[model samples]
Target: MESVKAQSYDVHIDELAQAALNQHIAKNDYSKTFVLVDTNTKKYCLPAFEKKFEEPIDSIFEIEPGEENKNIQTCLQVWEQLSNFDGDRKSLLINLGGGVLTDLGGFVASTFKRGIDFINIPTTLLSMVDASIGGKTGVDLGSLKNQIGVINQPQMVLIFPEFLKTLDPRQIKSGYAEMLKHGLIKDKEYWDDLRRENIFEVASSIQKSIAIKNDVVMQDPTEKGLRKILNFGHTLGHAIESYCLENYDKKTLLHGEAIAIGMIMEGFLSHKLTGLSKLCLNEIKETFLQHFEKVDFDTNDMDAILKLLKYDKKNSHGNINFVLLQSIGVALTDIKVPENLFEEAFSYYKE
Candidate 1:
């Protein structure tokens, strides 16, 4: 239940998190208060949110759930609602849900009336550990993931792990993937410790992942350098997510599910390009396969996923940038990957 301070915000956990939120609401003079959620959160999380939130809320806005609803169109709906409710620069937006709602709500608040005050109470494990903590607020452009957004910090973030009880096992494992990513990138002990536990029994341990991510974000708020390392598996993970999303023939991947594949593929790149030891590489691949089902990617899927990589946010001067591992818990950034090796990376994952 300890609080971690970020560059401009504090992440408060569990019971005391509500106290911190009450303190924030008591001190700030918000003209009007709004809460944003998707249909899922509205059904499962809103009651708890209202019970803990002592102040009067001006409005509640609900959007459809899922990755597809995370777009400019959803933002437009929320913005229109805010305008209709007379939300002003002094208004406060409370984002209560998983990554999709929080991401879109933050973007809406950041751009509404030239930005308004907002805070995140991430309801899902994925957002609790990673998405809600980082100031990286944005939404998808078409089927491409997070292609439009801004680095706008929230007033604060409150994590009540109890909200995670509302999640299905698949969603829980989805968030667990990001937690594992944290250990892989920055804490080897964390990685080993996580692999031993039941993914459902590790809610108390999310603070470590949040702290790890916050430490990195503090050092590189705009991703100028060190922050890029946080994206270790995301480059191709996002591409895979986008491809699956647009290809109706395939099942859409949850963020962590796609990254689970991305991590294995990028771990292969690390072995090939960054000198990760063969033992370590096998350990990485084995660990993920133990928890995640290997996705079936044929020649067509691989070709389309590779084509989608050009649009990765990290690319510069026609180079696809990646964060590769020097070893577990250590990362290297901005590495240019060769096109020929892309298929081999997938092959490594398959093996």
Candidate 2:
């Protein structure tokens, strides 16, 4: 497979990914090389990475896995470790894990010494398709997702689809939701194709998802305009995700799981506010519900989630903005949704 070019780097897939990483390591002379993994990836992915790269890493840093751990405390720990190990501006950080690991690792490398080189070899399906492709890297601010971070590109994104084999069924299903969002916002045919596809046997769809996300990032790296479209379900999805992560009473929702609900709810908003047809709205909600188990939110859950909306990065002038579909393959960005519709959207999701 050919490498997909980003604004500053290339995203290499499958066969091309290994060569890209090996060549990149061979070519760079770094002060130190460190591999960052969460607990799960450290066990499942590190051996494969070592065998493939065949390079002696100066150090390996591991964090606990899950969305809750994506925070300042984790970043601080990694920073101290890096500082103790004498990581300088010339050091290279190889992030080899899922979204939480990659997200936190990228932020740590970007800020150490005012920025250092980092490579993302995303291990799980979610990271493979979305998290590792874009230059956007950050950790959560308490219950808020990505409230603290930077817009720094990786040296290159290396994706090995075989890494998906390390994941359980639930994780793969979680990643698939992001791919569906890609279809809902940009390519309806791709969405239609995904409905019939199997996650256990995968490769082409992973690359296609990468291409969709990379295309958006390349055009608007800073997210001044076009890039906001990538946040299709994220506006409400992130709030719902954060709510679940911190509340022990609620089951912790995976990033995609929360976004699945968000997509359905936002699809409701799109139909009511953006001229999306009723048929398409039902299609969007039903499509997501097929793969993801629906969470029944009580009134309290809705109240907390709505309060969380103000913290969304997309909001401007005290108004929450959304990326809503005009139709299956087209999207509008920076859309301000009325407060009155929030309950209706949630009610629509419940129905």
| Root-mean-square deviation per candidate | 0.9, 1.1
What lDDT does model 1 reach? 0.91
Looking at model 1, residue 293 earns an lDDT score of: 88
- Give the winner by TM-score: 1
lDDT of 2: 0.89
lDDT of each: 0.91, 0.89
- Each candidate structure's TM-score, on Cα atoms with residue i matched to residue i, is 0.98, 0.97
**Please, what are the lDDT tens digits per residue for candidate 2 over residues 202-316?**
5678888889988888888888998889899999998998889889899998888889999999999999989999999998888888888889899998999999989887788
| Superposition TM-score, candidate 2 onto the true structure | 0.97
Candidate 1 structure quality by residue, lDDT tens digits, 76-163: 9999999999999999999998999889899999999899999998998999998877788899999878889998999999999888
Instruction: In model 1, state the lDDT of residue 113.
Output: 88
